[model samples]
Target: MAKVDAPAVEERQKGILGWIEKTGNKLPDPVIIFAYLIGILIVVSVITDWMGVSVEHPVRVNEDGSPVVEPARMLFRSELIEHLLVRMPTIFTSFHPLGYVLVVMLGAGVAERAGLFGTAMRAAVRNAPRFLLTPAVALVAMLANLAADAAYVVLIPLAGVIYAAAGRHPIAGITAAFAGVSGGFSANLFPGQLDALLFGITEAAVGSLVTDWVMNIAGNWYFIAVMTIFYLPVIWFVTDGIIEKRLGKWTGGAVAGSSDADDDPDAPLTAGQKKGLAHAGLAVLAVVFLWLFLTVDLVELVSFGAVSVWGGNPPLLNPDPALEVTQQLIPFFTSLVAGFLILFLAAGVAYGMAAGTIKTHRDTVEMMAGGMKDMGYYLVLAFAAAYFVEMFNLSNLGIISAVNGANAIQQSGLPLPIVLGLIVLFAGVLNLFVGSASAKWAFMAPILVPMLMLLGISPEMATAAYRVGDSATNIITPLMVYFPLVLVFARRWVPDFGIGSLTAAMLPYSIWLLITGIIMTIAWVYLGLPLGPGAEVGYTLPGAN
Candidate 1:
């Protein structure tokens, strides 16, 4: 790849892209925006509280069988001040994505600094055809979510490097991967952590109405698998045809923190780098084997004095019959973040040693430190975002708004298919304010699942619809936990890339995805397709058929 001045790449903004970019960039910095949102939330909470605004809690009911009402609470009280002042540290620390990014970067930093990532990218993509790059990244990004939030940190930036190596726009690469990882979040080939979480909530929500309803984590399996198939081309087209054209070209030099010595894509790997890659390869295999070993039943050992039995299904593969299948894999699913940290850390160390990048322990420490240093901006942004999210939850506005929306849909008396489509739209709209998929579902499932069931729409169908809406809007929402992290990634390539820029770039993916997802969902229902194993798109309540 040829390195040129960053400014050599022309900005060709036009049409909707130009308008969105112009309008979005007009906003203040992300931190200030969050602060403003916090103020607005407080005012909304006070007004809603004053007006006695409340909604009937869908799942929780009184002993007399009346729905429990949840009233909005004022956030301007003395208690609010104390919570903010006293719990400031905890609030920042407890932000879930904070630990995820920091831990993963600790390992990823060493990998990049030691030239492991750059070398690997060159070695992997050198012989590959350039045309297939976007689809490959899109596929991997969707599947990579099995590692949970680690994918956001690990894959998105790597996509940029991979694109740069192929002589394509790095920001375009980031856009495609971001869209797949987030906007196509629900569209994985197999069930993973999200399946377990959302389905667990679905099971509970339907339990009151249907006593024997067992949660099938794979309820949306076929639907999501099809989603994967459909989303691949959408991401590919948008990245190759739309985003790349808008991005113009990649005349920029190597990304910061990368080894310029090894930046050329066509350059042959040195003997030392080759040896290092082999070592890193071995390290990755070992990590994979270790994780796999922990997922199966081991030999039973006789207890003798100081010895205990090793025989049993490991925690990673729970043998407990009482839990659902996905529930059983919870331990393993949750362990993926740690698995990735260890994986990257081990590979980087092995590569660094074999490739002559790390001569001393201090070198490795410095690499990790460098990685953390890069995260400085993200840490500040996360602080403001964490407080805003927590305060929104405490104010009861998010849940109340979701419940009221569901109530409105139920009362619309629209056709069942149209109502289902509305559920998708509602979920997508609600996602802007409540970014957590499980959080929004917990509030929604209670109302949607049972309500839809009464209308002869299966809980699986309702869950599937929610998945569509939840995923489609993720890339467009700054409130999404990883949105700032992605913005940080984009700025590494294009310093001018702002919150508005990202939102505008991702707006196309969001719109098309929601449209396609809604269409697929409604069509599946109309055709009476099976959602998954023993999961149908339509339901017949007991004694009604």
Candidate 2:
């Protein structure tokens, strides 16, 4: 290694990043690109239709056993592409990224940026026993996805602080959180916009292949719940045994300088504040009790039969209980509002007692306003992202590519395991270019879901497989919208660290999980366990396949 002064090293690093930044800045975001991609897909569909390359299924098998729904020709000619493109605007815009992030996240922003998230996280870390850091972080990371950006933006930085406070390298904490947030992206009990969006595409895809194909939002909920448990130990071992000690203090990536806040010694909570918290706790329990009492299921209270957990037809997006059921405190996006309300009350009482600033509604409103103050930049980003996603999906080019490619995979007659592996790999590869899970899945589900069903795979299982690959590679993809923000965090801790270094550091996680998830999937299929309520591993039925 060349021994250069820090100044020269800094300048050289800047030059490299400056170049990369310039190139990246010129690149359209995934939303815009997806729009263009959707357009291309539309063009192909038109071409294929004009060329008469599509297959038509009669009520009976016409000539070949090759089902019209699963025909290989979907990808072959250009017209199928046009059909894909034309239909994209409706689908993509509905799941538009701007709308995608904002609807659920407004309350998230309120809860987090208002200092509730930060204070709570710091408190948890500060109070956590040493043995609990790894699992705690892993759990928080997965749950943080509930707030989407809050998890990445707030939790990642806090991880560094938490790790450093524990006498470990801050980077390790950051990495663990990053792994949880990005790597565990698909594993959540509650449905978010992403879950709803992906389910729609998978449903469309599966329906195209089967006469009775359906997909629900809780498709992977049970398996992911298991994964949360499975991964907690893995993260705990890796962090405590490998990451912490290897993460020596104040190294290249550990936080230095004045910016590090976790270094501050914890101030004692006031006796009054503690008392206030007792009040808040009782209030929260009361609210929860009332909520539970109101929502007692018909199956429990009467003989009206089971309540529709999925909320009805189109089970994945609908709250219809007919399809699937999994645990969640509130309905997907709406829960954010409910959560923030509780947090606001809880935190407000604590703050009031400690600071002696509040006794009325005015004070509470001010606290909320403070939260809103922190949200300016994100709202702009959200609006821009929304427009970008909407436009890109209109393009349809990406859709054609996914549809065509998936068609090829279906006809290959590869063993189920092999096909799953290939899909995982394919997902990883595509991730290099695309970062939005729903957008990519929107492109893929219509093609892959149906094909998998033809081969006796369930839509739920296929969605889970796709989730694994999509999530595993998130850490490695520079194209991810938040990738730059993460680099900024890394550089805070390791000022000398470059973008490449951060990516390289994260690669171990991405690679390891990719392999682990594949093995898990094979095992899951072998067990023939329902992926979730109404979700199965094997073929639909003897006659169906």
Q: TM-score for each prediction?
A: 0.64, 0.69
Candidate 1 ranges beyond 4 A from true positions: 1-15, 61-67, 129-264, 300-313, 317-319, 413-545
Every candidate's CA RMSD: 8.0, 7.6
Give a tens-digit lDDT track for model 1, residues 1-545: 22323321234345654554455546566667678888998899999999999877655669998877878889977887789889999988866556666777788778778878656655654455789988887887887665455567667877787788777899998999899989999999976557755765676566535666766656788999999999999999898989899989888854645554443445678999999999999999999888876864433323233432335467577778998776677667556656767887899999999999998999999999988998797688768766776676677676576556556666876767778787899999877766667656755665577767767789889999999999999998766778878877787788777666887899889999999898888888888888876678888766454
**What value does the lDDT take at residue 519 in candidate 1?**
88
Alpha-carbon lDDT, every model: 0.76, 0.59
Ten contiguous residues with the weakest lDDT in model 1: 1-10
- Whole-model lDDT for model 1 versus the true structure? 0.76
Error of 2 at 282 (Å): 6.4
Clashing pairs in 1: none
